[model samples]
Target: MTERRQSVQQSPADWVARQAELYEESGGTEGTTMRGAPCLLMDYRGRRTGDWRRTVLIFGRDGEDYLVVASNGGADNHPLWYLNLESDPRVRLRVLTERFDARAETLGHEEKQRVWPHLVEVFPPYADYQRGTSRDIPVVRLRRV
Candidate 1:
Protein backbone atom coordinates (compact mmCIF):
# COMPACT_ATOMS: atom_id res chain seq x y z
CA MET A 1 0.00 0.00 0.00
CA THR A 2 1.12 3.60 -0.60
CA GLU A 3 2.12 5.63 2.39
CA ARG A 4 -0.35 8.23 3.58
CA ARG A 5 0.97 11.75 3.17
CA GLN A 6 0.81 14.26 5.96
CA SER A 7 -1.44 17.31 5.78
CA VAL A 8 0.32 20.64 5.16
CA GLN A 9 -0.16 24.29 6.00
CA GLN A 10 0.64 27.47 4.12
CA SER A 11 3.60 29.56 5.16
CA PRO A 12 3.07 32.14 7.86
CA ALA A 13 4.26 34.86 5.54
CA ASP A 14 1.26 36.51 3.95
CA TRP A 15 2.82 37.01 0.54
CA VAL A 16 4.11 33.44 0.37
CA ALA A 17 0.75 32.05 1.35
CA ARG A 18 -1.00 34.19 -1.26
CA GLN A 19 1.46 33.23 -3.96
CA ALA A 20 1.09 29.51 -3.26
CA GLU A 21 -2.68 29.85 -3.19
CA LEU A 22 -2.79 31.68 -6.50
CA TYR A 23 -0.38 29.28 -8.12
CA GLU A 24 -2.48 26.25 -7.20
CA GLU A 25 -5.83 27.99 -7.70
CA SER A 26 -4.92 28.84 -11.28
CA GLY A 27 -3.46 25.40 -11.89
CA GLY A 28 0.00 26.93 -12.24
CA THR A 29 -1.06 29.26 -15.07
CA GLU A 30 -0.75 32.22 -12.72
CA GLY A 31 1.94 32.93 -10.10
CA THR A 32 4.46 31.13 -12.24
CA THR A 33 6.90 34.01 -12.45
CA MET A 34 8.82 35.95 -9.86
CA ARG A 35 10.79 39.07 -10.74
CA GLY A 36 10.27 38.34 -14.45
CA ALA A 37 11.85 34.89 -14.13
CA PRO A 38 10.16 31.49 -13.97
CA CYS A 39 9.37 29.87 -10.62
CA LEU A 40 8.05 26.59 -9.22
CA LEU A 41 6.21 25.49 -6.11
CA MET A 42 7.79 23.02 -3.65
CA ASP A 43 5.72 21.13 -1.13
CA TYR A 44 7.63 19.56 1.76
CA ARG A 45 6.77 18.21 5.16
CA GLY A 46 7.52 20.30 8.23
CA ARG A 47 10.24 18.67 10.32
CA ARG A 48 8.72 19.77 13.60
CA THR A 49 5.03 19.35 13.01
CA GLY A 50 4.98 16.77 10.22
CA ASP A 51 2.55 19.09 8.44
CA TRP A 52 2.93 20.01 4.79
CA ARG A 53 4.68 23.29 3.92
CA ARG A 54 4.87 24.99 0.58
CA THR A 55 7.17 27.63 -0.90
CA VAL A 56 7.44 29.35 -4.26
CA LEU A 57 11.04 29.25 -5.48
CA ILE A 58 12.86 30.56 -8.52
CA PHE A 59 14.51 27.73 -10.39
CA GLY A 60 17.01 26.79 -13.08
CA ARG A 61 17.06 23.59 -15.08
CA ASP A 62 19.96 21.13 -15.09
CA GLY A 63 18.94 18.69 -17.77
CA GLU A 64 15.86 17.15 -16.13
CA ASP A 65 16.69 18.19 -12.56
CA TYR A 66 15.61 21.48 -10.95
CA LEU A 67 17.86 23.84 -8.99
CA VAL A 68 16.78 25.99 -6.08
CA VAL A 69 18.76 28.33 -3.85
CA ALA A 70 18.24 28.41 -0.12
CA SER A 71 19.63 31.88 0.36
CA ASN A 72 16.95 32.99 2.83
CA GLY A 73 17.64 36.48 1.48
CA GLY A 74 21.22 36.31 2.77
CA ALA A 75 20.20 35.53 6.31
CA ASP A 76 22.68 33.78 8.60
CA ASN A 77 20.46 30.72 8.98
CA HIS A 78 19.23 28.38 6.29
CA PRO A 79 15.59 28.62 5.21
CA LEU A 80 13.14 26.45 7.10
CA TRP A 81 12.25 24.58 3.94
CA TYR A 82 15.85 23.62 3.39
CA LEU A 83 16.21 22.45 6.95
CA ASN A 84 13.02 20.45 6.67
CA LEU A 85 14.25 18.74 3.54
CA GLU A 86 17.49 17.86 5.24
CA SER A 87 15.54 15.62 7.59
CA ASP A 88 13.30 14.22 4.82
CA PRO A 89 14.15 14.57 1.15
CA ARG A 90 10.87 13.42 -0.34
CA VAL A 91 8.95 16.35 -1.84
CA ARG A 92 6.24 17.40 -4.27
CA LEU A 93 7.04 19.80 -7.10
CA ARG A 94 4.94 21.83 -9.50
CA VAL A 95 6.49 23.28 -12.62
CA LEU A 96 3.90 25.46 -14.29
CA THR A 97 1.05 22.99 -14.87
CA GLU A 98 3.13 19.85 -14.37
CA ARG A 99 3.39 18.16 -10.99
CA PHE A 100 5.82 15.47 -9.92
CA ASP A 101 7.56 13.66 -7.08
CA ALA A 102 11.20 14.39 -6.42
CA ARG A 103 13.98 14.00 -3.88
CA ALA A 104 16.08 16.97 -2.78
CA GLU A 105 19.85 16.70 -2.61
CA THR A 106 22.17 19.37 -1.25
CA LEU A 107 25.02 19.99 -3.63
CA GLY A 108 28.56 19.67 -2.33
CA HIS A 109 31.37 22.21 -2.69
CA GLU A 110 32.64 20.97 -6.05
CA GLU A 111 29.13 20.67 -7.45
CA LYS A 112 28.26 24.11 -6.15
CA GLN A 113 31.31 25.53 -7.92
CA ARG A 114 30.09 24.14 -11.22
CA VAL A 115 26.42 25.12 -10.83
CA TRP A 116 26.77 28.51 -9.12
CA PRO A 117 27.26 30.47 -12.27
CA HIS A 118 24.29 28.87 -13.98
CA LEU A 119 22.09 29.65 -11.01
CA VAL A 120 23.27 33.24 -11.03
CA GLU A 121 22.36 33.46 -14.68
CA VAL A 122 18.80 32.40 -13.86
CA PHE A 123 18.47 34.84 -10.91
CA PRO A 124 21.20 37.48 -10.69
CA PRO A 125 20.25 38.57 -7.19
CA TYR A 126 21.57 35.23 -5.93
CA ALA A 127 25.07 36.65 -6.41
CA ASP A 128 24.29 39.63 -4.24
CA TYR A 129 22.63 37.44 -1.64
CA GLN A 130 25.71 35.25 -1.34
CA ARG A 131 28.02 38.25 -1.02
CA GLY A 132 25.89 39.70 1.75
CA THR A 133 26.18 36.69 4.05
CA SER A 134 29.04 34.76 5.63
CA ARG A 135 27.19 31.47 5.59
CA ASP A 136 27.48 29.34 2.50
CA ILE A 137 24.04 29.29 0.99
CA PRO A 138 22.90 25.88 -0.18
CA VAL A 139 22.02 24.97 -3.78
CA VAL A 140 19.63 22.03 -3.92
CA ARG A 141 19.05 19.70 -6.83
CA LEU A 142 15.63 18.14 -6.95
CA ARG A 143 15.96 14.88 -8.82
CA ARG A 144 12.97 12.90 -10.02
CA VAL A 145 12.30 9.75 -8.06
Candidate 2:
Protein backbone atom coordinates (compact mmCIF):
# COMPACT_ATOMS: atom_id res chain seq x y z
CA MET A 1 0.00 0.00 0.00
CA THR A 2 1.21 3.51 -0.77
CA GLU A 3 1.60 5.93 2.08
CA ARG A 4 -0.56 9.02 1.59
CA ARG A 5 0.45 12.45 2.87
CA GLN A 6 -2.19 14.80 4.13
CA SER A 7 -1.94 18.50 3.32
CA VAL A 8 -1.38 20.54 6.47
CA GLN A 9 -3.96 23.04 7.62
CA GLN A 10 -2.29 26.33 8.40
CA SER A 11 -3.25 28.61 11.22
CA PRO A 12 -6.27 30.83 10.65
CA ALA A 13 -4.35 33.79 11.99
CA ASP A 14 -2.95 35.71 9.05
CA TRP A 15 0.45 36.45 10.55
CA VAL A 16 0.96 32.90 11.65
CA ALA A 17 -0.05 31.53 8.27
CA ARG A 18 2.28 33.91 6.50
CA GLN A 19 5.17 33.10 8.80
CA ALA A 20 4.75 29.39 8.29
CA GLU A 21 4.65 29.96 4.56
CA LEU A 22 7.91 31.91 4.55
CA TYR A 23 9.61 29.43 6.83
CA GLU A 24 8.71 26.42 4.73
CA GLU A 25 9.25 28.09 1.39
CA SER A 26 12.77 29.11 2.29
CA GLY A 27 13.57 25.67 3.58
CA GLY A 28 13.71 26.93 7.17
CA THR A 29 16.05 29.77 6.26
CA GLU A 30 13.57 32.62 6.31
CA GLY A 31 10.90 33.27 8.93
CA THR A 32 13.10 31.48 11.45
CA THR A 33 12.74 34.29 13.95
CA MET A 34 9.68 35.86 15.54
CA ARG A 35 10.33 39.29 17.05
CA GLY A 36 13.97 38.36 17.73
CA ALA A 37 13.09 34.93 19.12
CA PRO A 38 13.96 31.74 17.30
CA CYS A 39 11.02 29.75 15.96
CA LEU A 40 10.26 26.29 14.66
CA LEU A 41 7.51 24.85 12.51
CA MET A 42 5.62 22.12 14.34
CA ASP A 43 3.27 19.70 12.60
CA TYR A 44 0.70 17.73 14.56
CA ARG A 45 -2.41 15.68 13.90
CA GLY A 46 -5.73 17.27 14.72
CA ARG A 47 -7.67 15.60 17.48
CA ARG A 48 -11.07 15.71 15.79
CA THR A 49 -10.30 16.08 12.10
CA GLY A 50 -7.27 13.77 12.07
CA ASP A 51 -5.72 16.04 9.50
CA TRP A 52 -2.24 17.49 9.67
CA ARG A 53 -1.90 20.95 11.23
CA ARG A 54 1.05 23.29 11.22
CA THR A 55 2.00 26.26 13.37
CA VAL A 56 4.93 28.44 14.21
CA LEU A 57 6.08 28.48 17.81
CA ILE A 58 8.87 30.20 19.64
CA PHE A 59 11.31 27.63 20.95
CA GLY A 60 13.86 27.61 23.71
CA ARG A 61 16.66 25.22 24.42
CA ASP A 62 16.68 22.93 27.42
CA GLY A 63 19.98 21.21 26.81
CA GLU A 64 19.17 19.12 23.71
CA ASP A 65 15.40 19.26 24.06
CA TYR A 66 13.23 21.97 22.51
CA LEU A 67 10.73 23.81 24.67
CA VAL A 68 7.52 25.57 23.61
CA VAL A 69 4.98 27.51 25.61
CA ALA A 70 1.20 27.16 25.55
CA SER A 71 0.61 30.69 26.70
CA ASN A 72 -1.85 31.46 23.91
CA GLY A 73 -1.03 35.13 24.46
CA GLY A 74 -2.27 34.79 28.04
CA ALA A 75 -5.74 33.66 27.04
CA ASP A 76 -7.79 31.58 29.43
CA ASN A 77 -7.93 28.66 27.02
CA HIS A 78 -4.94 26.77 25.73
CA PRO A 79 -3.94 26.99 22.09
CA LEU A 80 -5.58 24.52 19.75
CA TRP A 81 -2.23 23.08 18.82
CA TYR A 82 -1.49 22.41 22.47
CA LEU A 83 -4.79 20.67 22.91
CA ASN A 84 -4.20 18.56 19.82
CA LEU A 85 -0.80 17.48 21.07
CA GLU A 86 -2.32 16.59 24.43
CA SER A 87 -4.45 14.02 22.65
CA ASP A 88 -1.63 12.89 20.35
CA PRO A 89 1.92 13.63 21.37
CA ARG A 90 3.48 12.58 18.13
CA VAL A 91 4.77 15.55 16.11
CA ARG A 92 7.15 16.65 13.42
CA LEU A 93 9.40 19.65 14.11
CA ARG A 94 11.32 21.69 11.61
CA VAL A 95 14.12 23.60 13.25
CA LEU A 96 15.99 25.72 10.81
CA THR A 97 17.03 23.29 8.10
CA GLU A 98 16.55 20.12 10.12
CA ARG A 99 13.31 18.20 10.44
CA PHE A 100 12.63 15.30 12.77
CA ASP A 101 9.94 13.39 14.54
CA ALA A 102 9.36 14.27 18.19
CA ARG A 103 7.07 13.57 21.10
CA ALA A 104 5.51 16.37 23.10
CA GLU A 105 5.75 16.13 26.86
CA THR A 106 3.91 18.64 29.04
CA LEU A 107 6.04 19.42 32.04
CA GLY A 108 4.58 18.96 35.46
CA HIS A 109 4.62 21.64 38.13
CA GLU A 110 7.99 20.78 39.64
CA GLU A 111 9.65 20.29 36.29
CA LYS A 112 8.23 23.53 34.91
CA GLN A 113 9.39 25.43 37.95
CA ARG A 114 12.90 24.11 37.39
CA VAL A 115 13.06 25.40 33.83
CA TRP A 116 10.66 28.34 34.00
CA PRO A 117 13.41 30.83 34.51
CA HIS A 118 15.34 29.60 31.50
CA LEU A 119 12.21 29.77 29.38
CA VAL A 120 11.53 33.32 30.50
CA GLU A 121 15.07 34.27 29.59
CA VAL A 122 14.49 32.83 26.13
CA PHE A 123 11.44 35.04 25.60
CA PRO A 124 11.02 37.63 28.31
CA PRO A 125 7.41 38.33 27.40
CA TYR A 126 6.49 34.91 28.72
CA ALA A 127 6.64 36.29 32.25
CA ASP A 128 4.08 38.90 31.35
CA TYR A 129 1.91 36.31 29.66
CA GLN A 130 1.86 34.20 32.80
CA ARG A 131 0.90 37.10 34.99
CA GLY A 132 -1.86 38.24 32.70
CA THR A 133 -3.87 35.05 33.06
CA SER A 134 -5.24 32.98 35.91
CA ARG A 135 -4.41 29.74 34.14
CA ASP A 136 -1.07 28.12 34.75
CA ILE A 137 0.61 28.17 31.39
CA PRO A 138 1.95 24.86 30.26
CA VAL A 139 5.49 24.36 29.11
CA VAL A 140 5.96 21.51 26.70
CA ARG A 141 9.21 19.72 26.10
CA LEU A 142 9.76 18.25 22.65
CA ARG A 143 12.20 15.39 22.44
CA ARG A 144 13.29 13.49 19.40
CA VAL A 145 11.39 10.25 19.00
Candidate 3:
Protein backbone atom coordinates (compact mmCIF):
# COMPACT_ATOMS: atom_id res chain seq x y z
CA MET A 1 0.00 0.00 0.00
CA THR A 2 1.17 3.52 -0.76
CA GLU A 3 1.55 6.02 2.06
CA ARG A 4 -0.25 9.34 2.03
CA ARG A 5 1.90 12.22 0.85
CA GLN A 6 2.20 15.55 2.64
CA SER A 7 1.50 18.73 0.74
CA VAL A 8 4.21 21.31 0.25
CA GLN A 9 4.01 24.01 2.93
CA GLN A 10 3.75 27.64 1.89
CA SER A 11 5.49 30.64 3.37
CA PRO A 12 4.40 32.01 6.75
CA ALA A 13 3.49 35.38 5.30
CA ASP A 14 -0.27 35.40 4.76
CA TRP A 15 -0.27 37.15 1.39
CA VAL A 16 2.58 35.11 0.00
CA ALA A 17 0.98 31.86 1.05
CA ARG A 18 -2.31 32.88 -0.52
CA GLN A 19 -0.62 33.85 -3.77
CA ALA A 20 1.17 30.51 -3.95
CA GLU A 21 -2.12 28.72 -3.42
CA LEU A 22 -3.78 30.65 -6.24
CA TYR A 23 -0.91 29.95 -8.61
CA GLU A 24 -0.89 26.23 -7.92
CA GLU A 25 -4.66 25.78 -7.81
CA SER A 26 -5.18 27.47 -11.16
CA GLY A 27 -2.38 25.53 -12.82
CA GLY A 28 -0.33 28.73 -13.10
CA THR A 29 -3.01 30.51 -15.06
CA GLU A 30 -4.01 32.74 -12.13
CA GLY A 31 -1.84 34.68 -9.68
CA THR A 32 0.92 34.81 -12.28
CA THR A 33 1.84 38.33 -11.23
CA MET A 34 2.52 39.96 -7.88
CA ARG A 35 1.85 43.69 -7.51
CA GLY A 36 2.03 43.93 -11.30
CA ALA A 37 5.34 42.12 -11.51
CA PRO A 38 5.71 38.67 -13.03
CA CYS A 39 6.47 36.03 -10.43
CA LEU A 40 7.13 32.31 -10.10
CA LEU A 41 6.52 29.60 -7.53
CA MET A 42 9.57 27.85 -6.10
CA ASP A 43 9.50 24.53 -4.25
CA TYR A 44 12.41 23.46 -2.07
CA ARG A 45 13.11 21.47 1.07
CA GLY A 46 13.32 23.14 4.46
CA ARG A 47 16.91 23.44 5.62
CA ARG A 48 16.21 22.15 9.12
CA THR A 49 12.80 20.47 8.98
CA GLY A 50 13.49 18.59 5.72
CA ASP A 51 9.93 19.28 4.63
CA TRP A 52 8.93 20.54 1.20
CA ARG A 53 8.25 24.31 1.21
CA ARG A 54 7.01 26.72 -1.40
CA THR A 55 7.23 30.49 -1.98
CA VAL A 56 6.59 33.05 -4.67
CA LEU A 57 9.31 35.30 -6.08
CA ILE A 58 9.56 37.83 -8.87
CA PHE A 59 11.91 36.62 -11.61
CA GLY A 60 14.03 38.23 -14.25
CA ARG A 61 15.45 36.45 -17.28
CA ASP A 62 19.18 36.16 -17.84
CA GLY A 63 19.63 34.46 -21.18
CA GLU A 64 18.22 30.96 -20.68
CA ASP A 65 18.47 31.22 -16.91
CA TYR A 66 16.19 32.88 -14.35
CA LEU A 67 17.21 35.47 -11.78
CA VAL A 68 15.58 36.34 -8.44
CA VAL A 69 16.55 38.87 -5.82
CA ALA A 70 16.99 37.98 -2.16
CA SER A 71 15.98 41.45 -1.06
CA ASN A 72 13.72 40.26 1.74
CA GLY A 73 11.99 43.62 1.37
CA GLY A 74 15.28 45.39 2.18
CA ALA A 75 15.73 43.60 5.47
CA ASP A 76 19.28 43.16 6.72
CA ASN A 77 19.10 39.37 6.82
CA HIS A 78 18.78 37.09 3.84
CA PRO A 79 15.34 35.67 3.18
CA LEU A 80 14.51 32.21 4.54
CA TRP A 81 13.91 30.93 1.04
CA TYR A 82 17.38 32.03 0.00
CA LEU A 83 18.96 30.31 2.96
CA ASN A 84 17.03 27.11 2.22
CA LEU A 85 18.24 27.11 -1.36
CA GLU A 86 21.78 27.72 -0.17
CA SER A 87 21.52 24.65 2.04
CA ASP A 88 20.16 22.66 -0.92
CA PRO A 89 20.46 24.11 -4.39
CA ARG A 90 17.92 21.72 -5.84
CA VAL A 91 14.56 23.35 -6.53
CA ARG A 92 11.37 22.90 -8.51
CA LEU A 93 10.06 26.10 -10.11
CA ARG A 94 6.90 27.11 -11.88
CA VAL A 95 6.99 29.94 -14.39
CA LEU A 96 3.51 30.48 -15.64
CA THR A 97 2.29 27.06 -16.71
CA GLU A 98 5.72 25.47 -17.04
CA ARG A 99 7.27 23.59 -14.15
CA PHE A 100 10.85 22.29 -14.12
CA ASP A 101 13.63 21.17 -11.85
CA ALA A 102 16.49 23.62 -11.38
CA ARG A 103 19.58 24.44 -9.35
CA ALA A 104 20.04 27.78 -7.58
CA GLU A 105 23.30 29.67 -7.41
CA THR A 106 23.89 32.97 -5.61
CA LEU A 107 25.70 35.17 -8.09
CA GLY A 108 29.03 36.73 -7.23
CA HIS A 109 29.44 40.51 -7.19
CA GLU A 110 30.82 40.74 -10.72
CA GLU A 111 28.19 38.47 -12.21
CA LYS A 112 25.37 40.32 -10.44
CA GLN A 113 26.69 43.69 -11.60
CA ARG A 114 26.61 42.55 -15.21
CA VAL A 115 22.95 41.64 -15.04
CA TRP A 116 21.86 44.24 -12.49
CA PRO A 117 20.57 46.72 -15.00
CA HIS A 118 18.44 44.17 -16.80
CA LEU A 119 17.00 42.94 -13.56
CA VAL A 120 16.14 46.47 -12.48
CA GLU A 121 14.33 46.94 -15.74
CA VAL A 122 12.30 43.84 -15.13
CA PHE A 123 11.26 45.05 -11.70
CA PRO A 124 11.95 48.68 -10.95
CA PRO A 125 11.30 48.42 -7.21
CA TYR A 126 14.41 46.25 -6.84
CA ALA A 127 16.49 49.39 -7.20
CA ASP A 128 14.66 50.96 -4.29
CA TYR A 129 14.97 47.80 -2.23
CA GLN A 130 18.74 48.00 -2.60
CA ARG A 131 18.90 51.68 -1.75
CA GLY A 132 16.97 51.11 1.45
CA THR A 133 19.28 48.45 2.84
CA SER A 134 22.92 48.50 3.87
CA ARG A 135 23.46 44.87 2.92
CA ASP A 136 23.92 44.12 -0.73
CA ILE A 137 20.95 42.20 -2.01
CA PRO A 138 21.87 38.83 -3.48
CA VAL A 139 20.92 37.84 -6.98
CA VAL A 140 20.38 34.13 -7.42
CA ARG A 141 20.61 32.43 -10.77
CA LEU A 142 18.40 29.43 -11.44
CA ARG A 143 19.57 26.99 -14.06
CA ARG A 144 17.54 24.11 -15.35
CA VAL A 145 18.65 20.73 -14.09
Candidate 3 per-residue lDDT, tens place, 31-108, comes to 999878899999988999988899999999998999999999889899999999989998889999998889999999
After aligning candidate 2 to the native by TM-score, how far in Å is the CA of 99 from where it should be? Answer: 0.7
Q: What are the lDDT figures for the candidates, one per model?
A: 0.91, 0.93, 0.91
Model 1 CA deviation exceeding 4 Å by range: 1-6
Preferred candidate (TM-score higher): 1 or 2: 2
Model 2 steric clash pairs: none
Pitting candidate 1 against candidate 2, the one with the higher lDDT is 2
Candidate 2 — worst ten consecutive residues by lDDT sum? 1-10
lDDT top scorer: 2
Give the count of colliding residue pairs in each prediction.
1, 0, 0
On the 0 to 100 scale, the lDDT of residue 105 in model 3 is 98
- TM-scores, all candidates, are 0.95, 0.96, 0.94
Report the error of model 1 at residue 36, Å: 1.2
Candidate 2 lDDT over 43-124, as tens digits, reads 9989998898899999998889999999999898999999999999999989999988899999999999999998888899
lDDT of predicted model 3: 0.91
